[model samples]
Target: MTGRNDEGAGMAGGKSPTADTDVLVVGAGPAGLATALQAHAHGATVRVVDRREHRVRPSRAMMLHARALEGLRPLGVTEELLNRADTTPEARIHLGRRTVEARLGHADLPDTAFPHLTLVRQADVEDVLWQALHARGVPVDWGVEFRGLFHGLTAESGGVPALSEGPVHADLQDVHGGRGVHRSRFLAGCDGQSSTVRGLLGAQWRGGPYGVEAVMADLELDGSLDSGLLHVAVGQAGLVFLFALGEGATWRMLATRPAVPSPDARFGQLGPPVPAEEVARLVRESGLGAAVREVRWSAQIPLQHRIASTFGNDPIFLAGDAAHAHSPAGGQGMNNGILDALNLGWKLGFASTAGRPLPELLETYGQERRLAARRVLALTHVIFFGEASPHPAARLARNVLPLLAPALPMLLRQRWLTSKGIRLLAQPFVHYRNSVISRDGTPPAKAWPRPGARLPDASVSVDGKLVRLHELTSVPGIHLLLERDAEPVASAALRTLLPAEGQGPLLHVHRLTSHPGQGVVAVRPDGYVGFRCGETDPVQLRAWLRLVGAAPG
Candidate 1:
């Protein structure tokens, strides 16, 4: 692929410094960085740009949900992040000064491997991702922004460009008065809501700002508070969440106001430098009034939810907040964005490297992510309002539901409105069924993804040494996990059905029955389960692998 400007010279010409890369990523936040990292691993030459001169001070998205943690495990940073943050096994729900705690470590939910939520500052998480990207030799051009994008056709020697017939070119600009141009097979918009890339693509973000407003701050408390439980207080004063940030320090507060008459106008300017008195009042209302101390950072944010109508427009695609934005009620922003990156990263890398038509595959990004986002929005509303059911019957049920918390474990289990909460609370990962990458098969039903929907992390004995499931399947391709002592016919079938050298990895078959009774599963690069069959059928397995860009030999 090639890029050039005949329009003018430098600033006068409205032309930017022209260069070529496999993929051009906008924004250096968690989402952008994660995309670049994944693309690089897939062997795509990547150039990541951001408008910020340096990493921003952390504020939102401190709670790492189980789904996000699972996604990060493959990136080889989950353990490091866990070491720097506090893990809360309990989610405390407060109603009108009454509190009920749900132990998330319940035995019935054992199907999910990651049961606890890890609380770490967003800055700390960014630092770990940045370090990983840097160590891998991927360059992030900070202080640079994606100005616009244009398309053309050309031949290249590196990875296959997404636009098989021609190369895709992108127009970029530096914040410091210089224009930089990048030519690549594809481009990704990891920029947050109000993304320049999304604007350039002319995609519409349709949704209203939630009528709720809140102030949040990070601080060191004067006294110790239990870091193992997330403390929430809900009342007329609104909802306040106190999360543990480790040490004697804590994420002081995130407080929400009741829905307002004018959603935009309700965002009151809390003064240039937040007053210490106001901070104290917020802490007091959060049930931590006595332990208030020096403030580290604070800001006011209004709740807003929106989803982009499309995630991809040909060579350009969107991920993270760029594709969708929602209220912070469930702490779903970062997790959602990271999962988006993981979904698109492998496909983008593979398409760019292997000469394949990516427009069809790229179209799937919005189809899959938007559905997940919609579900999350629905679930968040339930959590935000269901705590106080509007219907008299539902309200009575809520009151009575707690009473039967013991014997009603079974009845409540079936009617459990909480699974919606858990599904919405967990981060979502996109897999082959959502894209052109997977083998041919009827897509699974639209309920929460089963084992085939998301990846599962297990601590198993590998070669006589303990290792993670992700580490065992580290190649930048699809992996096939078979039960030990299975028929050799199954292995040959997978090879024939999957691409021999497509953007996705060929089959990496591992026998798991050495431990006995373990099920068979296949994992995608983005850490989602691709396919699983207990009793192997060569034809059925072949069909499933082919749908995800795999061909059994």
Candidate 2:
């Protein structure tokens, strides 16, 4: 398939007539692919380029939180992801001779369609996104390296500044030793921790590596351990996380040991395969109680927690590991990266195509996602440090788990505690209430979703057919959810608030048949409520629309 689609060039922020694509993504990893797919879904022409010649094959990240699934749902790949994923409804915490089984299904948090933890390989998720992009005739240019950014006048030399406004001019190198320039309206630095784009942008990565070395491998286990249960174990050395991964391997193993003496090792760097002896030692030290029969893939990773100084700098943006890297605690790395991509993806689609420089709209991408990353980083740091810290108190807690194992199941099974814990990990309720674009013109109600909150999924009748609230909002645009009113004038006026066709972000208006309240909730393109009011006051509704850069000037 071809890389560039000239058809959407006009609609895709073509201030520079010579631009090849709307967005130039510099990696084909999950974050990059999701960014490309999301931008393409929202009517932007995207080109994905990766320095690596082949797609990633290892089952690196082995779990997807509910929030990632919810974000991917709007992109139309959640169905395929669910089909290939293994849901672990129960986690078996091995505490010496005693085992504590805790349910993972979000039985207490019923607002979301994905109420359980989704376990799928990172490679599988990438393949699903790749197939989706391929189906749309968007080809990933493999073995293509992003050389630098230069002005169109001096395309051969890297003279252009990274923060230069207007269209971006990027120098690219193909697999065949050919060098050329590919221009786009925007650039996404999803290239990972050692990001060249971030380097070019001079973004400071602030944080240091954790004092723990982790090893992950997909292997066949020769034990009586049940495949359906997520097995977790923590010892004085560190922790072990084992899950059944059915594609090409029976189980995926991730264990952390004391950091070895490696002065040159950096966080987010993947080292060569660990020796069999080391792998055995890792399992033994972590008290996983499993014998590795076969090793399919293995990598040594130095754990670290770092967040970039900035997420976006005008025309240049960063996502995934390029923006933040943290310990693999609570399976938050890949899931957080996907969320970052989805959050920035739709905003990029809106700003790049809005035909005018919406600095306010573009600024919120950094404001919202940076704060989200900071929260994830802080959470993962606490969890990882608590799990792997060599401190005496942490070790004492690990040593005492066996004595408390008898009561742990009952405590973990409590809906109130489990729901709060899962919500913290799943992050479905992450809101942007403080964002400039989010506004609440009505008093906060206890039963209704407020501005900046995630649009909760509910079954509502559409033309006498029951459909999910998300299913209706899945169409690429801002969704205005209005309560069905006997007088249609309010909803009618709200519909007229959308920008003229092709002038701003696409907007979809839907009347909720099951909504008992008399307010309207305007869901942003990224599925967060941007505005909510008791009634559809045109002045307030139009003001919110304009704030999000979805209204014609």
Candidate 3:
């Protein structure tokens, strides 16, 4: 039973929002917002919807990692994130009287613009993103709930006559029980762990929950905690972690101590109210002895890890928490999820608008991101079990860890004297070496990354102003990067391949004489090398471009 309200057609009466859009994005959380922003930045018409009527104030993820910031910088939202977030450079591990501190400072890692972890409430991050979206004329439609999915043009709605083939329809309900239907070329589900879209699509998750149960709460406290570093205390009772919320005497405390698991008013959902005694006892046992003046919010999370078998079901694709769920141990969930949107955003943006055959483009999103999530799940699993496990071996290790804490910093400084140490903690190195779009067959005359590897953000001069290499590729389409010496033949060949009227916005031609390599590189909008020719082989480069949907396919 559904009410079909006439006003629910769209924000305007001319055309349904979904019908006008190339894609419909579900979920208004961080990942959904990022997806919408990235898609729009890449020149695609997008509409976003979320079930929730209001933005939640409670923090889900408190730390934004370096790699996420790097990936997001192209969208021009990084500056605001930096302005609002608190920077932390270290994580200290304390065992009774001994301590070992590791510095995650950005100063030591020169490869990225955002070198350190930024501690801000997840709400703040969302606020900044929401503001950016609104400022750019892309408004998030709140209170609209996604109810059901339809294939092609349904007879009941019969909306948007132009949409004839390969269109997906979504049934949406308003807050007042009003119903409407919208159509799109694709649907992106950035929903959470309890994803309605994933459930409707019948995609199964392949992992299980962690064994440990913990209590996390944001509280105003007074202790010897360093606001500039993450404080971890390991004892026989259990493990305790303190992360600064970038506010005065307020921190998010994650602890698993010798206590009973909390029983919430609702089962399987976080943000349940906990007994005062449980919160106090847990903190007292952490050895921090910080008094909880006020508890803004509390949650009892039985950490779970889940990854969908595939990221999508044809026209229905999953991103963000809907695609995968993991422990908050490494602070990788939101960051990794946002990165996933960046990976798929440009692909979807171009594919939806290309109006031509992009045979291998759309499917690569699942192939590349699904594999990355598997690796992330493995890494975060180890981190949670090692740092927060309640095992007998873990208890024993906690005791011995203090003895080794004294020499840990010196070992880091002396042994990790190279870039390897810093790079280890960064996001996992992701490259789609075996994906069909990856073509590493062409050997370069000069040094260059393979087709599947990241296109390094080399320093280059644009319009006589020095800028990072990513700035050039951030524009909408394929970028042909070549050294000045290699440009004569390379540019001529590309010009001939392009139509006589001149190139469409789908391809950007750049010849940087400042670059040191004599090779030619075809960088995709998502910043991966689609093709590379080390030598002067314009013919092979043209074929590679055609294969990547850059040329007429």
Candidate 4:
């Protein structure tokens, strides 16, 4: 651990160097690179290493939820991502010829900057993150693979283990030629599910496979159609999804039967080839047969859900698929991983620069994210197999709900389903209640979701620009304070609590006069509001700052 250095001296852009960075981030996927970028911004020297010689494979995680957009906003790439991708605001779930077009954009829900999920290729998202990281002075070492980890305990004057300082070693295998050893104060594993870091740490990944397989293909369509809707057809043939990819392309697909083996076994079968004729038939059923003339990419993937037993072990930690693997039913895989990176990035940066033991802050990573992953698994089950009810009464309600869709107001309300579905699909809304990192307090008991809850999306103005509440709080490694009027004194006091230099565990203070009941609240980098204080409790504010290891006045 070391103090923050403001000097922007390190490898950035395309400059390659053989130097030791403060942090070694393995895996340049959404999770790894994001961790690297945020850590670098916080003023820590970062070196990102990835096993792949080239960019990540252009497969998986095509659906970018609204919350993910919120996370990207601070990274300064939300608009770029939207430009590179298409969107589907509504989705139709066809159950045995009984088509139910669920309006995902519900009217009652508060509007967001990114109201609907954006559909973009995985490669594009990674490309943007890579470029952003490079521009900020952290570059990834592509084609370098993480082999194993070396751990040695630091001893005090006596023969006792010194928790604060230790030498951690990493064995790396370069794709081009030689083998090398890298040392760092901390390490992050953004590698996929079969993580070498997790293996070396001997962390347990618990959860079984859903036993479903799927064939996926990315293609360009020929005719005109609303590229704003995702179509899920569940007929006698099986379940298939037609996602709109930008540039008049559609992702035509199918959901296979659940596998009988463990989660790992199921993931092994992803990306098998499918016949072009069958793909054409699926397109025809979705009314896109004439529009689709070419298949750009195709593969098969298994649907499995699981979370690592622990998110980290001392200096080494996990994020993205490395920490948790889940069913792609709701397109939640990448979203979960990115959120993990967002949560861990600032904490790691803060701990490293402050000279604190990594374990003190690292323990919270799993406590918060594992809960989210589990909840996501539950929601996926509800959407995929949660029975509305086989009872005659319940059956009638299910059938009648769709028939009433034509009404003027009802049609508009149906849009809420998409928002709700997206809420369920993306687990950002889960609050950290029981976790050690979260404060112990109850919100109003009658609140529908309860207190210590994720504050829902609301309309607000940022620097005179109207923006979604979620968008106002996306910068990573920052503690955001939303208030009604200028509190320069409070802002200065908060700044004094931060480290002298380094990217910031960023501390953002805003005044929201428009929303009256909303008082002084502190949101963590992962977008979780950690502390909510009324204008009255100055003492509690100081206590929270100290609890989070921030500087004291």
Candidate 5:
């Protein structure tokens, strides 16, 4: 079910008749759209499919963190996101009698372009990404459902003449029951928590539902609640979160109160509707002074914390909610999934188009991201437990929250503490230093841009124009950034050591006069430093490139 023996069959030479596309992405949500876009950006032909006949209008996830924005920047969608986003810098936390403001902006952190926790409906993001895909001439095959998976060319229904080892043949059915086969070098499952692909791969989905139950509704509210700030109300009753949606509904509310057990109440799925009066009552009780004029949509969400045993299953891989699902405590679900797509996108592009076996390169996608998901799960678990648990300790913490309100402003005033804390929540702190693809040719102390860490943004002159370091690495392929004084090699000379023409992503080299003497940093397509060295040694650089399949072995 894993490993490829005929890597060259579908790459380099004229398109192999065995496969219809390089990457076939299932599910057209945020993750799937991002995966397809990233793969396409990296030179892979992609196909996207979603089971729904039309796009969903409801916005499930509502926050886009800094790291996800950084990851999506290279795809040319970040500007639009910023334009449409609510770049609110703070959230007001209400605790019974006291209200405190928590900072959500990057005034304290100066390394990234995205400066705040962007508040935008998930539907707007999907629309932007789908539009990007549309501009690329890659349309989503809506109403097409992924039914089953088969390896190689022997799959029934339009089977290829020759049997191959690498490509995946997936069975798909349209809304009308028309059946067909989609053959691709790689298949990505961006399906939701109830993932058919994860089930088909037999990956163990570990974990269970959270004891807390919550209801989410988008309502037209007539109230004095500040429309510019995210609102959080914490009490022994439970947690109530409100956001100014600014669209179909005036505000969005997510309240975690013990569900009233009605015989007709449905638990997990979209709802046995939460009553209008009950919705208004929850808001009123939270002391937000908001009256729900109209409930646009309401649903009871059964929260769960779970992750798959493996992210990649050979030619088949899972991303987004399919790979992991956790409490929306920090609003990490959609952001984590977007970052997951960025991690796996370029890897799939390389594996499908390298024209040579790249087992190590392919394997790192799962190794790096699976561990990242585990860490996110741990973080969200703690936050969710603190916010929703009925334990004495949790109750004490909630009761004491108001007492600490006086200190909140003082704490937020500390630039270092606030920056570090916001960076942690914003996800710029996530790194893959231990990944196999990350290599350091120098001692840790000497590694200025540490391998496996995100390539930090720095202003430097590129051909007499000042540009951020990330702008240089934003393009598809490997970027070798060198200080003018550290490495004497010409950009043309460095290009000679990369993979044979057309074998892999192009290796772009830049010599910046203003770049610090950090030796050489080869940034990966996903904006992480894959290789870093104090001095540019051809042997070391070549070895690192070859290790990551960026150079011919």
Candidate 6:
């Protein structure tokens, strides 16, 4: 808001302290912190604000898919998360009397450092991001409630309705009793579903209640529910899922039943609140044999699946849950939101430094993410309905599902089929094929996946020493990995295109000798390969840069 809360590297990283910052990120959750950190890394001065003074309590997000982990790598937070999270490779779904289990491991994919679903509370993830942001000279200003835009509107979403707006002029109130108005070149609504930014912008959030309600609680379990195992049981009483929460004999318990009251109804459509007695009863009825010694926290959440019609408008943008909401079936909500921030941060970083809001670049954020969210929402819906529907076929599958878990290996030929199943649960397969920024070119035979996919991490030798591909490429700019001709060296054209040390264009060039005869791969800051072509072909390189809006205009 005012300089009283601003003491970081001015937004756009080096900009001097001013009421007009480059990027004012709202909410300090994974999405918000990620947006702030990535923007800071790109040298944009950033201000991160959160209405709450603390991290999310009773953490909701519990799984970090491979793609999400990869997205976090550049932020310097993924490795720490890897060290702390539990790697869950398989889940046993006990439907009726059947136990559907399969080996769900990520190790089969060599590109992923942590192939398994990293299980850590969302709070821990935020802590890691927050610590990194703090180190970068940006700290989260907690307990600041966003009121509204300062210029054109007169309404406070949080309190007294007083607002105005032009561009992204924002107003904030320090819960400790101070109010100030400020403007950022760009503002991100990384806040939760009830996003102030989204509401003020009047963006349409389409979709309705997911027709399901799930009661959940985290508690010390009976240890019989082994760590790293997620078990789901569906019966006439509805669906119950159980999974361990790190150590301390604690586990998260959930039960989803048929639709309750609608948010518009007198009862208000939400997860009908569940008491400890109800949780215990649901657990016992599902035959999940875990003694709940103590309950830490519990709530009834009406599962929701909604996506914003548009991601953002000009100086204002939406990300994370604020942009899209997902059904909890695949645990894709938080991860999808994180990826959204990842996609937008670099673009904003580049545009902010260019001294003007790049309209096309800003517009691409909504185009890419809104479409991606549709796919995720659709996928999660099928899975949710398949397990919870009352139809006969759906019922038959749920009943016979667990029985196949044991026979999957033999029936589907363990290695290949199980690996495919595991791949479905991970995010490595997602690509921005339709993105205006993602281009394609003739690729080498050695490339495992096609262009537009996040470049797979590899180990290559440079200067006679082995170096990880990520180590050199994980900087704040575009990275060019030109395959060497059996030696560690870059072609003349490749070297010519490289920027002088610490200068404009934010380009990093490296010659990788491990994959001889391969072409040059240009990777975006988000780590997705823009395109690949002959190592000496500067034309293709220039084209890729322009496509991603990274080339010199």
Q: Which candidate is the best by TM-score?
A: 2
The CA lDDT of each predicted structure is: 0.62, 0.77, 0.71, 0.63, 0.77, 0.70
Local accuracy of candidate 3 as per-residue lDDT tens digits, 1-553: 1113331233433233434477788888889989888887766678888877666556667778766776777677888898877764577877777677666554355556665657767888888888878777665777788876654444323222333356777887756566667776778899788777887767887786666666878777766677777888877756788887623336888786433444432212465567767877777777765677777777776667889877874467899889888877777888878888888887777666566756577788999999988888888788777777778887788778778777777875652452354454456477777788877535653366777777776687644677777778655567887765664777766654442242246566777767666677777766677777766586788777766555555
- Name the regions of candidate 5 deviating beyond 4 angstroms: 1-19, 151-164, 259-272, 442-447, 463-465, 486-490, 494-505, 516-518
Model with the higher lDDT, candidate 2 or 4: 2
lDDT of 6 by residue, 338-433 (tens): 888898888878776654446776787888788888888888888877866666777777666665566654754456566565567665446776
User: What's the C-alpha lDDT at position 392 in model 2?
Assistant: 85
Each prediction's TM-score versus the true structure: 0.76, 0.90, 0.87, 0.79, 0.89, 0.85
Clashes of 3: 2
Root mean square deviation (Cα) for candidate 6: 5.1
lDDT score for candidate 5 against the true structure? 0.77
Pitting candidate 2 against candidate 6, the one with the higher TM-score is: 2
Which residue runs does candidate 6 get wrong by more than 4 Å?
1-20, 88-102, 152-167, 221-224, 246-249, 264-273, 390-392, 402-413, 440-451, 485-505, 516-519, 543-552
Error of 5 at 302 (Å): 1.0
Q: Write the per-residue lDDT of candidate 5 for residues 85-140, one digit (tens) a residue.
A: 87755788897888888876645666787756788788889999988998887757
Stretches of candidate 3 above 4 Å error? 1-19, 152-164, 246-249, 257-269, 412-422, 441-446, 460-467, 474-476, 492-506, 514-517, 535-538
Candidate 2 lDDT over residue span 1-553, tens digit each? 1123322221122222233888999998999999998888766788888887666566568788877887788778999998888764688888877778888775566678777777788888999999999888776777678878776466433223644455787877655556666778889999988888888777789998777778888788777889888888867676788878645688778888777767787567677789877787777665666787888778898877899998876788999999999888888989888988888888777766566777787788889889988988888888887898888888888888778878887898787887787777887546788988878875432355767788877889866789988788876778877776623665566565444465443777777777666667788877888888877666777787777666654
Candidates arranged by TM-score, highest first: 2, 5, 3, 6, 4, 1
Error of 4 at 17 (Å): 7.0
How would you encode candidate 4's per-residue C-alpha lDDT over 1-553 as one tens digit per residue? 1101221222333233357777898888888877886676665778888777666565566778876777667777788888887653577654443445566544234545666666777778888888888687675776677767544522112211222366456666665455566777778988887787777667788886554555677777676544567766543333567766532345545444334454335362345566777566666754333455787666666655677888875677888888887666667778878878877777777676765554545687778777887787677655555222233553455455445445534454565654665655556556776655555323321211222456566777766778766666766555555555534466656656666653354566676656554346766665666666545144666666555555442
Q: Write model 1 residue lDDT over 121-181, tens digit each, in one string.
A: 7788888888888787666766566666544433232332345455566656555466545
